[model samples]
Target: MCTYESSSCQTGETVVIGENNPVGSGNKGKRFCPQLVGTSESFFIPVNIPSSFSLVARNIPTDQTKIRSFDCILRINEAEAGVQSTFFNESYILCESKEYMYADDLLQNNVSVSVQWNGQHYIDDPTDTYVTLYKCSVNGGSCSRCLSPEATPSFLNCGWCGTECNVIESDVCQSNRFVNQNETNLCSAPAITDVRLSHNYFF
Candidate 1:
């Protein structure tokens, strides 16, 4: 009497793919240690910056990849801005149009930005202009923008353009209202001394 034990009895059945080739050799391959990372932070390095240099802020659309063209008037130590405006010769943003950069590194040192945000350039006017002063380390790595002491920071201005008046006849820049963010102020441009770069975290 042939008796099949339920604990260890099974008819050997070969599971096979009915489609494809009837018979063939098989080989496999793969890769290991795949590397991945994301590094984006703007940097401003000062090695041998031209005494006079100019760059466009290249505002990118916050919602999409569109570019905004605006002039950045930069100056150093209460100096004239246009004097250095001619030296500008580079594109800061990746997008040809106003497209928001993924990270600050996209704009940092890659773009030539004067450290100082001196308000002498724009004629001071509380009602018409808004000024926003940004502080940065000499190394051009760390930066603090908008001098909001409590509700309102110091030295920095916004919502009202910028400083509404200049030093009477300082002649640092043309008499103008600070409407555009690309507009530059008399800042210790390009080659600023150790003392020139403000490390102040607050006003």
Candidate 2:
């Protein structure tokens, strides 16, 4: 005697069903049903770093029937960095960390992000859950290293100028010295240009 609507069943959407026989139908006979969705993909980003940054996860499925809290764990170089709990009602989650992570600390650029629902279910893929860390400014590093394909992944937008690596629009490097990731040849060029002297003198 239970009737359920199939067309109304949608992800994150709920519908109620009850018996229509009418002999002894009570409130307890009604069932609350919630549509659960599976997480297809999830990814996070370091919105800001070295001071205060928000770890944001996108496209994460949510179950409203479960607890409203979830845990987000961050791992750097295969070591656990920290974990923070976040509250969300939708498919998006964010956790903010004030810990300072220097460029030297993330030189390896190996980071992993994962999330758990009420300490019960993990919602992200295990095999392809690595996040690429981007740091263009490192101590004692040359411009070539900053603009190299190996050093600067396609996702990072940075350029080299003089002795510093900055965002492409930062204008830190002069016209002739500015080299971006697109200029592959400039990565191999010498950082300093040589000037031939006509005469030699003692300082």
Candidate 3:
């Protein structure tokens, strides 16, 4: 459901890997339903995070019918980060989150994210993707040499391990920092409202 445009049939082209369906049980008689042929109108799922608890939607492909392939990604502010996916049916789920979606206390005082009055400083993990995330709002300068794509992964801040910043601000690191680590404020602090998810993309 990620990019529904009737693109290709690569997902269906395969030999019987296991004995789930009937025809696939016999070799040379492998069941092949790889190509999902159709025009897909992506659904708009909304995920508004209310204070108290965070919500995660696992194995989202199960909820969708006629699903050929599906994937879900995470984002900070609006910058896109790396995404995970599943082909046909695998052990992994279609959609998943890190952790800590909401809390009544998070709605009132300083949240898991560092925050001051300056408006959501460079503190990391505004969305609380994991238990411990670092926020570092720095200009995209020699970042690959300074950070880890997994620790602070983003198109704007992603690279091989130990590769510092190599691009400009708009093309790379901007004003926000989202490190999936222990609470380490690389920049300053920023007040956060409830962490939010777009239901239009979820349920």
Please give, for residues 1-203, the per-residue lDDT of candidate 1 as tens digits.
00123234234411222235355222111111111111243222222222222222321112222212323333333442322122212223221111111122221222222311122222111122111122221212211121122322322222112332221122221354332222334322345556655677776
Model 3 over residues 138-165: C-alpha lDDT tens digits? 3224333234444344433322212223
| Global lDDT of each candidate | 0.24, 0.50, 0.29
The predicted structure with the larger lDDT, 2 or 3, is: 2
Root-mean-square deviation per candidate: 24.7, 11.4, 20.6
Q: What would the per-residue lDDT of candidate 2 be over residues 1-203, giving only the tens digit for each residue?
A: 11235354565443343466444233332233211233443332322342222334443445555455566666764566545554444434555443424245443364666666666656544344544455566521776777776875545566777677755444454444767778757665564668787687888
Count of clashing residue pairs in every prediction: 39, 0, 34
Cα deviation in Å at residue 72, candidate 3?
Answer: 1.7
Best-fitting candidate, measured by lDDT?
A: 2
Model 2: lDDT equals 0.50
TM-score, structure 1 vs. true: 0.15
Candidate 2 colliding pairs: none
